[model samples]
Target chain A: MSAPFAKLPRWADYGLIPLINLFVAFIVAGLVVMLVGENPFRAAMILVEGAFGRGQNIAYTLYYATNFIFTGLAVAVAFHAGLFNIGGEGQAYIAGLGVAFVALSLDTVLPWYLTFPIAIVAAAGFGALWALIPAYLQAKRDSHVVITTIMFNYIAGSLMVYMLVDVIKPLGSMAPQTRPFEAGAQLPKLNWIIELFGAKIRSAPLNLSFILALIMAYLVWLLIWRTKLGYEIRTLGFSSKAARYAGISESRIIIITMLISGALAGMMALNPTMGDQHNVSLDFVSQAGFVGIAVALMGRSHPAGIIPAAILFGALYQGGAELAFEMPNISRDMIVIIQGLVILFAGALEHMFRPTIQTLFASLSPRSVGLAAAKKEGA
Target chain B: MDFLNALVLILDSTIRLSVPLLLACLAGLYSERAGVFDIGLEGKMLAGAFAGAAGAAVTGSAWLGLLCGILVSVGMALVHGFASITHRGNQIVSGVAINFIAAGSTIILGQAWFQQGGRTPALGAAQRFEAIELPGAAALRDVPLIGQIYSELISGHSLLTYFAFLMVPFTWWVLYRTRFGLRLRAVGENPAAVDTAGVSVAWLRYRAVICTGILTGIAGCYLSMVQNAGFVKDMTAGKGFIALAALIFAKWKPVNAMFACLLFGFLDAASIRLQGTPIMGVRVPVQLMQALPYILTVILLAGFIGKAIPPRAGGVPYVKER
Candidate 1:
């Protein structure tokens, strides 16, 4: 058969295509803004200014990005293993319980540094436990992980509500949350970082967790690219049949990969619960787990890519809040619309423009196209 | 007599609540049976609810509201089809995107246009679907148990509720008896065979997707116009997921789907009634009851009941071998 389409150059494949998709997504989001009778460019300008205009704004953006970084890493790990672990929302929320439990117990005696490591372990443990059942089911029972994970999300919501309302809420407390942790449990704010830039951070929740997120990103890179397990995961993701032929245990890989994914998702709780809220609130995760899917997709499931994508989303979240305050007509929900459009364009309809672009490139230089075809045949 | 009245009351609510789930389950049944898995039922229903409320409020006609909802929902379905069918994109990712789009855009547009903070004006009676009392219900009201069951549990509901129930049998007939039904099922199980038989797999799947849009639109219209009288933000809530769970619990069969939805609806209605009420001298947490449907589905999916195998070709785009 004739070559279906010309192969894209590395730069065009990795960089240009995603950029075009992002541009299309923004254009659609802008059209949505225009439909509501708002000027799209002004809204965009306000959004950008709100995200990066001040030191506090930048701090807030990073604060949001920290959560996305954790979640994005979670999704990317699973993507490498050919698994879709959408239960990150539930896992992270449940991990809050572990974090809160550790924080509540240790805050009375331990210092912030001591409590922090224990909280991370607790969070990762809970998240991994949450993912275990779905992983087991997918590996052993042949049940699809997607539906089960979605179900687990609802189950997690119910469990959290019960824990908050009936079991954990302090007596005589009207609200459904634990009493605030003592000072030892709180992560120190990264106000000094802003100060070093000759600007003051005013009430933004940017904290030590941002550094933790970056460290985790680096560790994730090491794990996926430098470790044997990472090689196995990538191999399995490429083709389970091939992995099986190579004598890899499919069930073991699936479960282990999902556990790692769940742990990363769980660590996301550390940001909001410890860094900012200082207590486990009902909406602490606040859909950051879902945001991870978009980040992972936009980043092409790489840590190198995820950090920047997470920051972009963080900007959207921070700026969207400002936009809501300034523009009465456009609420913060507009950011969610942009998010959905990004997922649709960047993730699902990624190849919508590929064929046309390929044809254009083929016509530009037939020699390169022929060379690429020959290379493919040789490979 | 008191116990019976309570039972009837819960059953009445059960039917009302089940209507949307039933319609949505059937909608999923059609699309999934045609090998196109749909996790976007929630999003479509939410969008439909908003469009239905807005359309009815604007034109002062419930019928026109339904038309608007159907049109919008169909538009979304076509997008899903384009991605999953044409581009061979991940079905779950496409579904997730649709849901987020619906969740975000409905509220954004609702706030922008109506200015009621992401809600349309409370609909007028003329713009709503009022319940219909079945014939002879008044005469049978004095007949005790039968009377209560007939008049209270079954008789009073909007036109859409009856249609939802009716669609079950109709759906069964369509799936089992019609030539199109055979082709649809065959295409889902093995698309290549149908393609070799000179039928376009894409066209058949598109038709199924459109049917899903229509049914889900009705479900949405029912939510806004019949059940609540106006649209609310995230009003569909997790009902779409419950319908999905019900679909799995039913193993994608039409008759079984109705019963599964009814079971879930009963759980919901009972939970509402059981709130703050001690059961056997113990206060049951409402959250447990709220989570029961999901937990039970997971259990069933794990093969505690029976395996729920989807259509053989589900979620995979038909790629002709070169």
Candidate 2:
């Protein structure tokens, strides 16, 4: 067989290909916008301005990115171990419950400093607990994590519905929600830190959680690249038989990786529940967990890659919300079509244009020319 | 008297609720059995529902609506085949993308055409598949013990529900008793062997996926034109996923998948019935019953009932060495 286009440069393989895919996705999305009777360039400008026009807008985009970072990391953690832990959504939902329970139970008793740390632990712990069942099932029972996680998402929804509607709704209120947490339970916004640097900052939902997400990203990098367990996880992913021969336990790695992934997913709850909403409400996790799949795919499951990929999606989401407000015809749901196109190109049809691009790159490179000539002579 | 009536009512709802699940479960079965795992059943169903509603509204005929629904679903299936079979893309990612597109496009188109908040116009009786009365319904109702259960719980269902029930047996027969079924099963387990036997693996999988699309189409039409009126935004909800869970819980067998779907339907009926009702001197939350089926599915998959092994060739793209 031909040699997979004679080995493209690292920059071409990692950066250029993804960029090309994104360009293709955007082009399709533009056509969709045109079909809806909007000028594609104008619509594109709207998205760009909405995401980065002002300090507050940038803050909002970053806030959204923070959620993606947590969830993308969660997905990436599992991807490394060759597990598709689609339970990130359910894990995050269930973890929100844990966060809500801690904040509700302890906000009055403890100070902000203590409460914040406890809530973070609560979120991660709950998320991990939620993920463990499926991990255990996959490891021991031969159950597919994909199916179990999907089921758990439904169960989580039902659980949340019960918690919000029947058990936690304030006695006098008809809304399906718990009472707001005490002031101490709320997270501080990032503007305080920005102001310390003597720059005027607009108030947005951007919070300390953004900083936490960054820290988590760094920690994930350390875990995946610098540690022994990481080595085991990567080995198992590459080849189970090889890993088994090397005395690396497949089941153990699957469980550990899923647990870490679940914890990271759970950390996503910190943004919407603790950082912004200040209450566990209906569908609070929304689609962040699902969006994480796209982020991880686009980022190629790397922490360094995930950061920028997360930011790009965050912009799309924030900008989509803006487009909904500006255009009367294109509603919020229509934005999903664009998101779907991006996902289709970035994930499903990710390599549709790869071979062509590889060939194009190879023909241009001087080394490939020499290699091709040498192969022809040998033939 | 009240307790018996409640029991009858619950059974009645259970039958209605299981129709979509049964069809979608069978759809998943067909695809997976042919080595093409399709989690896009939900997306296909959504598209079918929209097209059905729109077609019925335009033509004023339920029969025409059904055709439109099937066409839309088939289109979706073809797209899935192109991505997963031809391009060798990740099946789950393609499924998820289909879902996103279906979910978004349906709402967008609905809003554009109907201007009714992402919903089609409420269909008239002529544009819907109404219930069919079983023979001697009035005579059967007065019989002492089994009368109420027979007449109230089983009879007078919509035509689609009966079709869904009939499909269970038909699916079983086809899988076990037909030449095509053998080839389908073999392709799923060991495609290379079937390929060696001169059967095209890609063609078999494509055929199965297309069959899935057709079944899901009828399921979607049933939802819009029979169970309820019109196409609502995200009307399929998580039914497709639940159908998947049911499929797994049944160990990918046709008859068992039907039972699993029924069980889920019963759970849904029970939840609706038990809502706001006191249990053991305390009010039980409606969500408890809603969650029961999913919780049970997880337990079943976790090996409480038994292990569910998927087809050996499932999720792996067939790569032939040229």
Candidate 3:
């Protein structure tokens, strides 16, 4: 209840709080690992070594990080506009249909270069279209965005199930995935491009999607921090009534923000389907869409902050896979618990340690005391 | 005669499916009515299913399994209350954490204990809920249409199913007739009013949340012990979300929630029946069938099916300013 009264210092607010939260989550996760009879320190060492020790490991880490980046940015965009678009998971799933449709139908007739653009456009367009319905409902019909989006996730799953089983099974295959994309449609791996610099980085799933994600992060920064629309969107998030009084259309901003967010989420499908799997399958989005919420929360919904936050999650994932294989007792679901802890600490329990930190900082610096008081929140 | 039998079968399955949804819907009604928007119903139900299945496997008693289910669900609800109510945390964020914790911990602990792919062993007759035969079923068996209806629809359901339906009227009475119900409703609409009236809003909300956990526990237990053989990973699936949607569609009314859940259950049963059943040459899509409830929920939320007005103070942590 006193959360609004906590006036944390700038460094403590932006840097220390998240770092401390991250440390606590890891510590708690370590305790869980210990509960399972494993040495906590050894497990942490294995996790770090497995994620970043080898060149190939780093590539895979980045590959997974790319997916998180897309989803994280999607969440950040919506959050800035004061909307929680939990529908990122559904949007990504729906977007996979677009990627599959393009790769299946047009890849044979067109070159890979041509098919590449077509698939990307299809993915983003489909994702945005899926988000548009909920956005319109929230803007016009007063339906809650969270409920609508969650429902759409189920709807999207059903759509994919229908498509895979009845409509596009490629004749006799009992498997639920489509046939692999044509060689022309396959996205190029990063090794090919990076090899030009005379460094021998091994071939990995890390591909063009990573670069595309970076470009997206930059674009998001420019849109949020630079553009007039970005300014309006933030204002809307801060106070919708104030935004309305300032002549901004609440509905228009909601729609636009959601569309852009959905587009980013859709792009996540490309990491698995195009970069690695080379085909569409059930649950290819995995839980990346959900992990994005953790990433965005940890990153404070900023592009610069999201990149590292995404890599941390990416590391947890890749390391988790390695641990599952190496240690029989500890399973991959432990990673989920770790992700949950991070989300719990960084998002829900975010202000738990703030008051204590603020008191410490205020006591240390008298000049900042007056300035910090100006930033105090609700009672 | 054949058509009538098929119709009877569908109706039977509908009732079976609706029992869990009905329980979950009522659970959500209790929580949301007290101003705590619970998206963690899935998590709580999943935890309950795991506990029920695991308990039955351990003790070989279905009754003990049911008790274990309730305890685990209540623990989860308490965690949610500690975060959202006590810490004044973001309610949605806290709910999401509970979901993640429930999902992750269930599997991790399940795999640790059973080593059967996060699933307990299939329960035996004594360890699983059995269908109870109602009185006069044998006498009614001789009757024609009424005979089949009585035997199939009314007589053979597990005890939990009856309890779930019975809870509807019980919930209605509690929310409408009792003093506690009035205070609970007042807290949701305006916590300040309740606080001014010398009632503790936090205590009321915590109790409401705990009741939700208990109801959701019954739903979860029914799934593991009655509907199916045992608990599997993510067995609750998205049933919790569907229940929430039903609560919304019913406009947060306990009795209306029962009808809404039954309609959804009917849709589910119809889809299963219609799956791959060619209607004049084209097979009906199972995916569309699976998606039916969600689509209906969206329509309802969009105000096409009906008007849905949420509690005014839902989702906002009640803050008493200095």
Candidate 4:
């Protein structure tokens, strides 16, 4: 293989890959919808409308994006550290429990000013603690973090169910969730901002959580690209033996990275708990942890990349929900197909796009493959 | 008599629960031993489960369904092998993708086929794997300890259960005693060295993965046809992952993997038993009992057990220089 210099054509190179992947995802989804006797075009239209057709839908998309941002950032942090942290689900579950407990327990005694921040902190702390176990194992025992974290998700979910049903039954409620937090414990809405747009526009329950998500994303960017600690993390992630040789403690970095990642996952609960929901519930965590993996992959594991990726996912999620509601035939399973496709394209076929596109363009052009490139250089 | 009864119950449940895991883990053992990580076992098994259920429901033949399950899972394994082996893609990502695809496609197909909303039609007794009591075992039940031991150790299981148990020794024999086993171990430890020695590393790993797919398919079929009588969407749950953990905790040895499967199975059975029994003057919530196996896996991995080393090059793809 002499250098392997075939490259993607300039005109269709950047935009074509995403478009091809989007087409693939929609086609797969269309097949499934069609199998269920639903019109594919109508279902696709419904999905688009659900995500961005109206102001309310856009707000809902943003509301969902808030959780996606935190979870996506959490995954990106660990991915940067070269660790696959599948335990985001478990950490988020534990953090949700922490949020619920703090919100409910402190609602009566503490004022909103102090309670909200404390609750968010408690959730993050709990999330960090949850991640600590797997980090310790990976650091000390050389156990794979992926297996341990996946197992912990089940453990965390079961533990939460047990706690909610038995020990923390919320006074008299029988549901597998805590009682609603007092009004003060909830995150205040941005209704005033929505009103500024005027004309009967009611913003969804999106709140300050979106700002916190953005801040966390920025903080992750700083930590990964700007700070010394971030340098140590990236070095260790690239090659642990090299990092160790370079005088960085791989164990310490692993533990710290996991802690930060878990804390971000824990913060994800803020969107659901502090928004109009006002309480943490089982459905609140709803695969946000898993979807974070897709977000991180779509974003190419960069903080700047993750914002658009999260919004894209948020749109898909919001749209899928709308499709389900509007068309009784299409189930929420279509979203799973779309997610799976996005992840497949963004992850497995990621590197192949440039080569594949180059090959296609080369075949389409009558001239020799190197001729176009030579012409461009000559120009 | 009561002790004998409890032993029998435990043994029966152990065999039933351990079959799926044993097959899956043993499959995992072969793949990992050949230097390929198989996190897609869960997805492969789910695919198998759905295929088995659908095949059985349509054809009304459990045997054909089992074959169908294996075929579907093998198809998935081929995809996994191609992606990781040929394309040199990330094993973890490929496995996760297979899982998501399996999960989504199964439910989508299940809804379309069964019209029961992601669950299959329940099979008749003949369509399920019936328990097989050994010949002359009926007389052995009259004896005291021997009867209990005979029944608990030797009798009362589906044919697949015995097959799963026998696979442990068979796997060990293959790994330690056979030429192919030596080559597989060699490849897993150092594919470059194996390649230097003229063995095709990619071919060996691909075979190991296919073997895993077949075994996991049997495991998934067992779940649908015997354990639950039919398939429920996502019913295999995380059992495949639990089996993977067991494979790791056992250090990837076939016999140790069997013991690990039993250990987990016992915890599973014990949890179910404990849920009925009172703990410290109060009944333990069923959810805690349900969580026992996963909690134990985490605890065992977290330095409670001694070091558990994975096979060298377990997740790395083999790229041959032309």
Candidate 5:
């Protein structure tokens, strides 16, 4: 074998790799579809159409994308800071519960405008607090954030089940969920825009929550690329020792990064409660947090990349539901299989493809000069 | 007599619960000691449980099922080892992949094979592993205090329970007393040094992970064939993580891990007992009791347990320089 260090790819070469990775991923996805006895072309067409074939379908897809945006941004923020953040699920859970409490308690008395801001703030605050514990442990005692956050997710799940089943059960109902929010508490829909699509689109709940998600995405981008704090986060992410030499406090960065990630995760709850489902329900936020990991990975952990990645995932999710309805034999789980394969291929893409590309490029340019040398000589 | 009874009850519950955790923790100890972070323990356990139950249901022998469970889990461990050790993939991502596959595939297979709605058919009492009653323990039953403790605490668990306890000391001996143990530690701490000394770091880590798989299989089989007598979807529920915590909390020492498992098991038992019990003149919701173990784990891990250090190079894959 050659020198072990010789195989390592330079950091600058990572930019063009994602596009090739995505193309390879789609090829793999096609193979998977063929294995499942479906025509890849038909399946791909149907999937795209299901997401955007009709105006209402497009609206619903965007609605799903809104939640993914928040959670994906949450995971990306931590990924940028070198944190895995498996606890987005738990943070979102607590934040959702916080939103529910505020929505139910203040719905009757507070005006719609006042109640909406209060609910969003409460959700974000609760999420930040939920994340603070694991962050503190990791910073202070060197505890592994992955294990701690996962434990907290289980605890959060159980607590939510308990709250829904016993404490917060609706007064007159036996259902294992909270009561629906009052009319005043619901986020106002974009009714005027829906008039153009006629009666079909009016039924879907397209509210102000999607706008909030977009704004949050833009803000996250600014925070990650523009600010001094962002510089510290990225520096520490690349190398902790270098960040320390640069006089950035690692502990403070960890805490602040986690809090910001948690707050973004908290905002994800608004998509279900205030937009699509119109209330805090147990099934409303199923595995959105876990799916965020895939979103972040597919997006290459960038804010702008996250939007399209979220839309892709949202399309697949909606398409899967439609397939389940149309073909009962296939089951809804094929989407999970697709999601798993996408993640597997995408995560391994860099390791698998970088060397192959370098070798291919090396053969084409026989002098064996590196890419940087070639570019410098050309310049 | 009352005090002895309470002590016996606690001891019995502790042993019963701790066996699974202890086995899994020791398994984690081996894997981490060889520098592979085995977070797929829960998924492996679930796979083992499903395979074990299916094997027993078909073969009509619990022992055969136990062996089958170990074999299936070893397959999973091999996959994990190959992905992380051979392919040099991210250990955490590979572990997560195994977990997702296990979670979905097991339930799908169970539903298809058993027609039991994501659960295996329950085993009859005779088909399950029987508890061993020590000879002369019945005669000691008349002694009031010590007799109750002896009969209840030591004599009535399945043979696997006894083996689990024995493995703790055996592990300690192997980890500290044997040449393999030293090499294993060296590989985890500094694989480059081990490679320089002419030891195959990859082979050692592979063996360590395989051992973890076997132990995890036993824990899973014990849960399904002996303790609960059936399999359920995602039944291991984060016990693998709890065991990981115990492994860390004990500083990856066998004896310390034994006690940590016991402490966690006792909390689990106490949580069960606390349900439906009145506290402060009001009945407490059982969910709070159920959440106690996780809450305690979080608190303990959050700067309260002094400092728990992971093995250096714990999750890094070793590639031998030729």
Candidate 6:
């Protein structure tokens, strides 16, 4: 079959298109900054300086990037199985309970390493359990995952509030958060990693969880590309009818993919609950789940691509806080604006400029176009 | 008499809360019935609340504020159309984008324009929609049960609330009795068939989307100008999602949507009253009550209540076979 839209080279399809989309998103974001009566160029400088200027700032950027990577990978896994798992926010939020429970119970008795492994299992277990209901509904009951997931997010929020306020708040303490974890429960800071570069810096929350995120990214790559289950997921994503014809169980793949996605999302809580805050606070997730959607879309649902994309957003978060402090007119909500624009251009309006770019490339390579036409005729 | 008095109060609050939900549910009904599922209703309502409050504050005219809200929502709807229809992009993704864009831009613009920290200035009585007492409310209020119901329950609502209630039957007529409605439903169920019959599927869907924008815009206006004095950041909360749930619970019927919204709204009103109040000697937690609507929606969607079958072509961008 002839291509409905002209297909470009692999390099152009992956590299050039995403680069252009990112450029357009930022350019529009710059315009929004200008609308707020701030100089977009100055804002950019501040954002860059705030995110990367100091060792501490860089550490903070990495810390934030660590969360994005986990959540982004979660979204990527679901995307592979043709599911929109927007419930990552809810899944990760609920996982805080598991992480805190393990820390609160085991931190005093067990060592850090022991607590860490148990926390991982508990977090992943809770997140997967949270996702199981929605996944089951989608697979067996014909309930749309998108709507169910959104509803689940709301339910999770309410549940967390109740748990914090009524169940876990220490009797005398007014705050809706637990007391800080014991030293054994806390993850070790990765400040030494930055020190290796010969940069003297203040302590940042960058922790061992960052390493864990990288490991998960690598594992995700293997799972999606190397495993039989991954092959089924990809096939189901491409077409349900074809997958069914090939004797793959659509319901099973969807359930497994969603569980994996939820587990990755749940693990995101570790970055903050154990790595940075050392306590489960109200709203620790704080829109990171939504950020994952943007990261996954911009990353094109691949681990290699997701790492850099997550860091770019991490820079936005770190720098946006600093920018909000420096410029009263431009608040931290500017980062949210940029995120929305990125999702709009990268995910929704992805192919807006593809036709024009394809035509331009065809015109530039007339000989290749003739060879493509000759090949099509021969076929 | 005291119990009766409390019941009236709860039902009254229920009516007040349900207006926005009712309007938004109808908005989603129009969009989804036309094969375009809009989860962005929340965002549009939020943007409308900001615009409505800002316009009223600037012009001192609530009517103009409503107009401003409608215009802004329609603009957002057109953006959805451009992405999902013209570009043939994923409808859900486009809706998600719209939601985020509205959520962010409203706050940024509100802060920039008003300098009140992501809110519009408080509106005065002249700048807002005030409750209208019916012709005989005062005289009839002194009478018995019928009088109390008429004066307290039926009357004493902002004009927009009445408009919302009237919209129920009007929506039913528009959906079932009009030729445009027939074409809209047909397009949603099978766009290819509509295209084969020489009706422009794109145009039909665009019109339906515009209708959604108008209804949601009015709902937003009600929140800021009628229900409250000004626009607060994220004021719409999760009402848009609640409306979507109501639409599903109603099985996409206009009349049923009104009742579903009322049912949910009553739950909300009852929850507020139930908070800190013991039921059967057990104090029900406020969080559970707050989460009741969403939990119920999940159960209903699971088909434990009944099936919620969406439009056949919902969320799929129509592509003409070459």
Please give the lDDT score at residue B305 for candidate 2. Answer: 78
Measured with C-alpha atoms, the lDDT of residue B107 in candidate 2 is 88
List TM-score (chain A only) for every prediction: 0.96, 0.95, 0.94, 0.89, 0.89, 0.96
Candidate 2, residue B126: Cα displacement in angstroms equals: 1.8
Best by lDDT: 1
What local lDDT score does residue B270 receive in model 3, on the 0 to 100 scale? 91
Candidate-wise lDDT, in order? 0.92, 0.87, 0.89, 0.83, 0.79, 0.92
**lDDT for each residue of candidate 5 in A280-303, tens digit (9 for 90 to 100):** 767567777877877887788888
TM-score of chain B of 4: 0.94
lDDT tens per residue, model 6, A1-379: 4233456877888888988989999999999888989999999999999999988899999999999999999999999999999999999999999998999999999999999999999999999989999999999998999999999999999999999988998899999998899987999999888889887777799999999999999999999999999999999999999999999999999999999999999999999999998999899999999899999999999999999999999999999999988888888888888888888889889989898887777667734434456545655
For model 2, the stretches where C-alpha displacement exceeds 4 angstroms are A1-5, A192-202, A366-374, B138-141, B144-151, B279-283
Residues B1-322, model 1: lDDT tens digits: 9999999999999999999999999999999999999999999999999999999999999999989998999899898999998888888999999999999999999999999999989999999989899998988999989987888888989999999999999999999999999999998999999999999999999999999999999999999999998999999989999999999999999999999999999999999999959998998788888899999999999998988999999999898765
Task: For residues B142-199, write the lDDT of model 4, one tens digit per residue.
Answer: 7888887786678877888888988999999999999999999988999999999888
**Residue-level lDDT for A108 in candidate 4:** 86
In the order shown, the candidates' DockQ scores are 0.89, 0.73, 0.75, 0.55, 0.35, 0.79
Ranking by lDDT: 1, 6, 3, 2, 4, 5
Candidate 5 chain B has its poorest 10 consecutive residues by lDDT at B104-113
Which candidate has the highest DockQ of all? Answer: 1
Candidates in order, TM-scores: namely: 0.98, 0.95, 0.95, 0.92, 0.88, 0.98
lDDT of each residue in B1-322, candidate 2, tens digit only: 8888887888899999999999999999999998888888999999999999989988999999999999999999888888888778888888888888899888877877788888999999999999888887779898865888778877889888999999999999989999999999998999999999998988988999899999999999999999888999999989999898899889899999989999999988887878768978987778777877888888888777777789999988887664
Evaluate candidate 1 and give its CAPRI docking class based on DockQ: high
Q: Write the per-residue lDDT of candidate 2 for residues A1-379, one digit (tens) a residue.
A: 4434457778877898888888887887777677767888988888899887767677888999999999999999998998987888989998988988998998788877788899999999999999998899899888888888888888888888887887788899987877898877888888665456554665788888999999999999999999999989898888899999999988999999999999999989988877888888888888889888888888988999999999988888888789878875667675577667767877788778877876676566637423566545656
TM-score of chain B of each: 0.99, 0.97, 0.97, 0.94, 0.94, 0.98
* Model 5 Cα lDDT, one tens digit per residue, B100-175: 6567556656665676767888887665788999987898977777788677788888988988999999999988
Residue A332 shift from truth in candidate 6, angstroms: 0.9
Rank the candidate models, highest DockQ first. Answer: 1, 6, 3, 2, 4, 5
C-alpha lDDT (0 to 100) for residue B101 of candidate 6 = 86
